[model samples]
Target: MDQNQIPYPGIAHTIKDKKALLARVRRIQGQVAALERALEQDSDCSAVLQQIAAIRGAVNGLMAQVLEGHLREHLGTEDQTPEERRDNLKQVLSVLRSYLK
Candidate 1:
């Protein structure tokens, strides 16, 4: 309930999504490390390009899941008061805008 941290949704809603995201990010990190090693080893261009493409696809998938979660849980209509709802919408928009950049 700290002012600096927004409340995350229920464990069932968030944990699974978070686990997936974390796994993808970890894979991306590994890919980046491999790419660096490839560069050090002077790897072939086609193999490097393939790994880069895979990393991009993984990042895009992660972003989609995060955006979907935001729309479903943070911005969805429910029983919130008007002011709270407006605040939620604002926060969601802010996050989306930041990510979209």
Candidate 2:
């Protein structure tokens, strides 16, 4: 989408959804705490692995959601000039490369 077609309200969009996002984060935190407790309690190896997998999935889901919003707000707009769009996309790609690593 171009800058003119920007569907999201940028940070305001995130702020509006902050409560829901925070709730998800809290749930993930709870899961992490549970994982810690399981380790402390000498849970079975398989159980610990399951907990780790759950945490990873949760984190990945969160990352995907945030990335979607960021792309929409920053790179998917039609308002920016072509040059600006290219620059923004490059920056986005750079961040993604670093993040993926």
- Winning candidate number (lDDT): 2
> Which runs in model 2 stand beyond 4 Å of their true positions?
1-10
Clashing pairs in 1: none
Query: How well is each residue in 43-80 modelled by candidate 2, as lDDT tens digits?
Result: 99999999999988888888777778777876787788
> At residue 93, what lDDT does model 1 achieve?
67
**TM-score of every prediction relative to native:** 0.68, 0.79
Clashes of each: 0, 7
Q: Cα deviation in Å at residue 15, candidate 2?
A: 1.3
Worst 10 residues of 1 by lDDT: 4-13
Model 1 residue 28 lDDT score: 86
**Which pairs clash in model 2?**
2-77, 2-78, 3-77, 3-78, 3-79, 4-78, 4-79
RMSD of each: 3.9, 6.5
